[model samples]
Target: MLTVQPLQPATFPVPGQFYMLQAGASYDPLLKRPFSYLSAENGSITFLYRIRGKGTRAIAALREKETISLIGPLGNAYPVPSGEFIAVAGGIGIASLFSLFGAATGRATLFWGGRTAGELLMTETVRGLVRTAVITTDDGSAGRKSLVTEPFREYLAVNAHLPVYVCGSTPMMKAVAALCSDAGARCFVSLEAYMACGVGACLGCVVKIRDSENHEGRFRSVCKDGPVFDASTVVWEGQ
Candidate 1:
């Protein structure tokens, strides 16, 4: 977890929106990395990220008062659910969905899963905010040993009318989207892509989306058109 306070008052990012962060003044890493806002309040923004590669390693090395460049509150936000909704998060993907709990107040339920207990950051914080939170770990170190989708599928069998919000690994989102489609529920997904430009200019971060009218597929820029999209509209891999 890293928190940054801008020198000037900052715009609070809507849930599911992300920022492109470039650590330090050097351009050795070249492209900025995208991270969804964990929370934004009182001119301070927080991001939850794992040190997976060079970009993240740079971010991890920053000291207090060091300067970094940021370009966002970018991409679309998840729709505010008017009724009860379920959120499915895989590992650190919870970073994007946490604010939705506040948006829905007592009407949200969260199904969160990680490969191990260590990947499940802020579990207690999430439990405090949602109506109910079901946790699962692949290793069975905490919660159930089953995939997070298992309990979500079971829940939908009973509460099929509720909408779903999802953010996770690509495979997890695709799986959850399939389940929602089968249950006749609406599902929104937050996508991750490599971005050369955080804005739309570079055309580097595109995903296939199926046209609603003709069913033809077209590429859309994830940086601008979404990081958040309706699950049914996305042309998942192998589709």
Candidate 2:
């Protein structure tokens, strides 16, 4: 968990929107890393990230009040659900969906799952914001001993009319989207991709999108067109 306060007040980012962050003045890493806003308030923004690589390790080493480069509230945001909706998050992917849970207030039911209990950060924070939170860990260190999607699928069986919002590992999102498709539920997914440029100019972060009419797909810039997209339009790996 990292919280950064801008030198000056900035616009709070919408849920599912992200910022490109470069740790120091020197560009040792060259490209800024994209991180979704966990929460933005009171002139500060928070990001929940795991230190997986060079970029993240560099970000983790920064001292308090050190200067860093930030560019964003970038990409499209998740639409606010007008009625009751389901939110599915996988591991740290909850960072992108936290604000949406608040946006839906008491109407959102959250299904969050991770391989271990430690992977599920801010469990109390989620419980405070959502109507009902279903937690699962593969190791059974926390909630049920099953995949997060298992409970989500069960819920969808009973209430397929509710819309779903998801952010997670690509495989998890693909599986959840498939379940939603079978259940006739609308599913919106927030995608994660390696980005050279956070803006649209580089054409580095493109994903295949299935055309609604032809079923043929076109490449769309994830940075520009979406980090959030309708699940039906996305061409999953096997499709």
Candidate 3:
């Protein structure tokens, strides 16, 4: 959890844009990584990210008194749920569901999968926002000792009418998408990509697809156009 400090408030998340967070002065790469907002209260925004490298380690190691820079509340939020909602997440994917749960009024079913019970941070975070079940790979933990999508599929089998949202590793997303689609369930996905720039100026995060909007081309920016897309709309080429 991030604490408010000698605040440096900035307003720059363009509904679907991102911010570059320069955690500290120790940036060996001379810059910070980009992050999407999970949720924001008052003026604070939440980011869901994993520790992977020196820079990431640097920020993760900071104590409560130490503060880092936050650059946004960016990116297009997923469409507000129109009906019963169910969300399936893997690893840190639960972050994507934060916004969804915030806007939902009906009972929400959430299935979060992590490597271990200790990693299910978002599970507890959503307690007040919605109903959640955490699943861990380690059998000794809490919920089922299966992949996050396993429980998702099981819920889909019985509650086929609920609208489903998913975010996680690409392979996991694809696997669940296929199963959900076959079962005739409507699904949405929030995607992840390696980004250098958080805005649309960089054409680095492009996804190939058959343009249905105008049929002009077959390319779209993941960072700009979406980090989220309907399961049926995404042209998961090469998958």
- Tens digits of per-residue lDDT for model 1 on 1-239? 78998876667788889999988777779889999989887779999999998888888999998877888889999998987889999999999998888876447889999999999998999999888999999999989998999999999998878989999999999999999999999999999899988888999989899886657678899999999999999999999
lDDT of 3 by residue, 53-164 (tens): 8767777777876778654554566776766788887777776676677676775787777777777775555776777564656454767877777777777898888888
Highest TM-score: which candidate?
Answer: 1
Per-model CA lDDT versus the true structure: 0.90, 0.91, 0.69
Can you write out model 2's per-residue Cα lDDT over 122-172, one digit (the tens) per residue? 899789888899999999999999999999999999989999999999999
Deviation from native of the Cα of residue 92 in model 3, angstroms: 1.3
Q: What is the lDDT for 74 in model 1?
A: 93
- Write down the RMSD of all candidates, one decimal each: 1.2, 1.3, 3.1
Candidate 2: where are CA atoms >4 Å away?
A: none
Candidate 2 has its poorest 10 consecutive residues by lDDT at 99-108
Q: Where does candidate 1 have its weakest 10-residue lDDT segment?
A: 99-108
Arrange candidates, best TM-score first. Answer: 1, 2, 3
How many backbone clashes does every candidate have?
0, 0, 5
Off by over 4 Å in 1: none
Clash pairs detected, candidate 2: none
